[model samples]
Target: MLTSKTRLLSLDAFRGFTIAAMFLVNNPGDWGSLYPQLEHAAWSGWTFTDCIFPFFLFIVGVSLHLSLHRKVLADHSETQLLLQLLKRALWIFLIGLALNLIPNFDFQSVRIPGVLQRIALCTALAAPLVVYSSWRGQLLVIMALLAIYSFIMLAVQVPDVEGNLVAAALEPGRDAGAYIDRSVFGNHLWKQSRTWDPEGLLSTLPAVCSVLFGVLTGHWLSAKRDIAEKTVWLFIAGLACLAIGQILASWLMPVNKSLWTPSFAVFMTGWALIVFACFYWLLDASPAIHLKNRMIYLMHPFIMYGMNALFLFTLSGLIAKMLGFIHLPQTDGSQPSLHALLYAPIKALPVSAVNASLLFALLFNLTMLIIAWGMWKKRWFVKV
Candidate 1:
């Protein structure tokens, strides 16, 4: 039921919205003290920052449903569907790798796992399952996958846990995930962790579950029901999912994204479903939504995603680095970084740190938006 124009446009807007948030939270003026909303929940809770990634994954599932359904309705050959899936997955995965090389290209130091790569793998795994099986089957698969991941992550002890099992036990409070990932990837792990990759192969199983939950929501949307009815069901479903996720998290697994716990998938998908219902009601069904149509301004988010997104994210980091490299001379001819210099006037006063960080993020995001606008003016959609 998605329109060629409207469907892609809505999806692009969703993608851009999430990516814009990514740039905002990531490039905050100071990480040490950020708005609690901007910081990812330390552990075992949700925050605004955590919503963005799951939202992206949910968007992926929404679009995938429309895409695969259209293929079926068109009577497309199975070969064609498979080919499209493979090509799209490869493209996303490769782009993630290519972006890892930006600001500096060092193969030895490059991260093996990243946002797009995780998306690519999750989509590849979820799509085939969604398209080939019934929605009930997909639901069962989601349950099984979550159960398996929970058991593997929380129950299975690392080989090296015992003193002579393989090596001395790690210090208390350490997770088994890091040890497992290190034993598997060793030196090929993420540079950030120096041992485990957050987007590692093992964690992606639950990532697939995230997509499966999205697919389940997609099925709910596709059901033969009026918009109001659909909205009501979606809200109910979201609440049910939240309850189930919390129950499972307490009993079987902890909701940790670094390990991609299945409970995290359920909880995030529940939130995404709730949001989709809100947007659908406001934008499509509400007669009083006078300015809702104006959201089309963000219709070309894919252009931002494919062309300027990585450029912009990397650029923000470079901007911070450049600020650090500044050597402004003080009255005593003492050198201070630009940020240090700027902080004197702002932080010296009693002001909310969040206000400053938000302003800086807004300015940078607007700059990225202008670049995206320029590309739009030229009809230049850079597809990956």
Candidate 2:
């Protein structure tokens, strides 16, 4: 029900940037030698890559808020809206589950908690709360969720490596979240580290706060304030949250993305707000600055990508899987996947291994861009 006039170009642009960044980071030709910024933190810290997933989740909240507002404006019944949102969430989660079964289709070790699954869960949990609560109530829910997660993480105890049930430690494998993941998923967690999964169950509780942060920002964006005034206040609010997050991290918890630590959530939320504010100021707030400028052309590809994000993300994943499935025998009588074959040449580039891997990812993103452009031209948008 959102018309052209109501649509926020800044939101779409930001979402597109996040999707594009995700594609680039995920599809790097060689994971072992990528740039540090592109790689996730080994355990406790964050890289630019760490921000990508949470940014997407936050965008989901914004999209959900806008969609629900449109539904309310259309006079849709709560039952109808609820059913629709539930169906969407379940379908997306199933898609995530199905993605894990790709060329191998091996269910025995398939990952349960994943990017799309997290999105589905966040949206499902946040939609009802947003619909039922006032803005003040939503703010309270955000605070309460963060507080409860912090307490549980700090106060709860589970057996450590020494066979003692004690308070959760801040280390990777020793944390309470890891214990829950191992208990529930058994051998079905992320294979990279059997001891823990980044998208585990307990960590997901704080991730919900990431979505709620977006929900609150969405509400603020749609408020009846003057555009410039809103932009200024958003900047101020973002800086304040950044300070608060830093203080909390320094005093109570380490800002860790894998844990989806409460401080990390607030910290990233601040970044998201500032980024959105900049986009709004440049693209939506000043019509002359946006439309009459040559720079507008640069925004076209990103906007197109945003228009059909879910489809592109899924297709990209499937294509990556298929590419890895096709194998060819090398001159040394060793079999290598198509991806390896393609990357082998890039590997010979007279540059750092990181730059070579980055080039491969850029090539993959270009291919996706072609598909996205085609979809945009045909006005075919696939949404979940």
Candidate 3:
């Protein structure tokens, strides 16, 4: 069994893989020319891109359980632990807000809801439960949150754009969550759709449950069980969650990432658990020393990326913004953004627009990987 003191290589690699995927989807050379799977589902379904955020949140849950549980066992004060988590959450939220303010420090119309912001909120909300609740209590909280969110989304009526009362509406800007976002954030919603924000307030209720799911998984892993048994049961639990999610999708709420529907949270948690189980079994739980060593060697780059995920995430967003903000003079006397200039060569290649865009994203990930490698070499880990 893996003890609390044993660092899980699998967790780091899984986190690294998710971060790399985030860079790929977020930094595509041409957002308009993306593979369907690379793009978020326009409405009430999911894509590979949609899985990344939930995966990261789930990892946060697992990490929270492992870390906080250890501290609690060590007789640390729960209040102090909570204070530290909230402080970290504040830093993360501020950084996310800072990213939105970049290139145009306009406080008037800047977005307040973002991926990092949502992560911060979820972490803060779940911190107390992880520190103070038992496994059963955490599970009950997850159920309660999901049920409450579903009820609000389905049973609550809200005013639509046309000033008509609509109930059970899941369309853009018409749902209860969207109404709450617009009412609360006003001009501070997502720029793409000012009527609604995907990472808005009410949706965060269910999002916190996503983290709780991961915490439960961590509880199971840290239990005094046989390694093989833990691996088998983890996979089974994931399957159970997947089944439940599908049932909910058909019977109640459809799986919508933007709304962060209960089905979506459960479904994505299932995927995260399954994926993490594979990693845990291969890297930490499995007794195959030679194969485990080989896998670790192969995944060194990801390990580096995972070591400084927050720093890399922030730095990458900053660089991407700069790439779009800075301009270069073109031959036709028209100035193009640095992003356009950099993508020009790849665009000229004899390839489909989608393929070219994918290539650029790959190159961007490689650049980040190189930076991660350097940071890893220098032992520079930026902790919040």
User: Which candidate wins on lDDT?
Assistant: 3
The local distance difference test score of each candidate is: 0.69, 0.84, 0.93
- Candidate 2 Cα lDDT to native: 0.84
Query: Positional deviation of 186 in candidate 1, in angstroms?
Result: 2.1
Relative to the unseen true structure, what is the C-alpha lDDT of residue 177 in candidate 2, on a scale of 0 to 100?
A: 86
Misplaced by over 4 Å in model 3 are 1-4
Please give, for residues 209-308, the per-residue lDDT of candidate 1 as tens digits. Answer: 7777777777766666786887788789889878887986887666666766777888878887787776666555445555556543334453355344
- lDDT (Cα, tens digit) per residue for candidate 2, span 189-281: 898887788888888878888898888877877787787888898799889878988988998798898888888998888888888787777
Ranking by TM-score: 3, 2, 1
TM-score of each: 0.82, 0.95, 0.98
Candidate 1, pairs of clashing residues: none
**RMSD in Å for all candidates:** 4.2, 1.9, 1.1
lDDT, model 1: 0.69
Q: Give the deviation of candidate 3 from the true structure as CA RMSD.
A: 1.1
Query: What is the Cα-based TM-score of model 3?
Result: 0.98
Once fitted onto the true fold, the runs of candidate 2 whose alpha carbons sit more than 4 angstroms away are 1-5, 287-295, 330-332
